[model samples]
Target: MEALQAVLKSNFRSFDRVAVIGGLVRDFAREGRTGFRSDVDLVIHDSKEEVALLAEKLRATPNRFGGYGYKSGPWKIDFWALETTWAKKHVPMQTLEDVLLGTFFDWDAVAYDLWERKLICHDDYLERLRTKTLEINLRPNPSPMGNLVRAIRRLVLWQLVPGERLMCFINEYLDEEALRYMQKKEEELFSYCVSSRWKTVEEAKFYLFQERGSDDLQLDLFQIKHQR
Candidate 1:
């Protein structure tokens, strides 16, 4: 964190507003215990062009995700343009509070203001993190599949169990439409994992079905057939 802080301070200190947001902030709040594989997400309350200029200044190459990223030692730093509308309404994201409000999950609605050197988070953000609870900050109204998958993944990774409300919401709220959306997402993710070599079928199945243990006769038969 010190090294990353130094890099950001040196490069973006002149900027008026800057904050480290997303999973990195969550990991930071966990006292460096939660392991994050992705690069750090930094939000600058400025135009995309301005962020592109900053990326140039920092010698970072353009990333495919409409951001700038560069690898420094073991850490990967990414800069993202701050936007107002993350889910539904298009609210201008001028303040840190706006960003927190736009977050998909309560636990993720935490940020460390680099300029102020302080943490800004939702009222329940810390509580949710502490309790390891997955609560929705913004309603997954249009599509709930992504959020559902994320919640389940976090539950597995964090070893935290969801409350009854969350379970009821998942089981009751999902209709045919939501189930179709989830199936599509699963197919797309599976294709990406295969094509990008991100995860083999076995690896994907292992993580997705980790709780099922290794005693599945179907999986055993499939492996035996493939080995022949």
Candidate 2:
């Protein structure tokens, strides 16, 4: 974090606004464990023209997801304009006081203003964190798979219980067909992010099939396929 702070202080001082948002801020504020492997999302409130120049200045690559990917030592940082974020483009989620378009989860909605040396988060963010629960602030997202996988990841990593909305999201999107993609992503994510295993399809089903609304949610989701 010291390296990140130093780099930001030196490189981004000229910018009108530069803040660190997403998982890094959320994790750091709670545990101060912004270690070498930490990834960051930077919110640069600026025009795309200047942001592109800034990306070049930092020797960062423009990612396909409309962000600049820059590696500062062991930390990988993604720089983005506030207006151009996927959350901002798809949803009108004004769930954060500091950030206009909030992220999918309330836990991820926190941002740390580097210049101001302050943390900005939603009113319920800290409370939710303290309780170790996950809540969805934005839905009908561009990437539903990403959202579902993250919920599962958080459930394992943080031992955080999925809130009603979050469970509904998981139950809605995760079907037998979608489970294959979920497993693929889980294997990749587990290898890259952490070590976890579902072992079998049935095992994963046991964990994720907690019906949030209707009792027939699982039955409605799965269908028997008789084959020769």
Cα-based TM-score, every candidate: 0.64, 0.79
Residue 10 of model 1: what lDDT?
86
For model 2, what is the alpha-carbon lDDT of residue 116?
81
Alpha-carbon deviation at 18 in model 1, angstroms: 0.6
> Which pairs clash in the backbone of model 1?
none
User: Candidate 1 at residue 96, lDDT?
Assistant: 58
Tens digit per residue, CA lDDT, model 2, 31-136: 8774224687787877777888888988999886688998888778888776576766566533334463457887877888888887787667678789767888
- Winner by TM-score: 2
Error of 1 at 58 (Å): 3.8
Off by over 4 Å in 2: 34-37, 90-100, 192-228
The best candidate by lDDT is 2
Question: For each candidate, how many residue pairs have backbone atoms clashing (under 3 Å)?
Answer: 0, 0
Model 1 misses residue 46 by how many Å?
Answer: 2.1
TM-score of structure candidate 2: 0.79
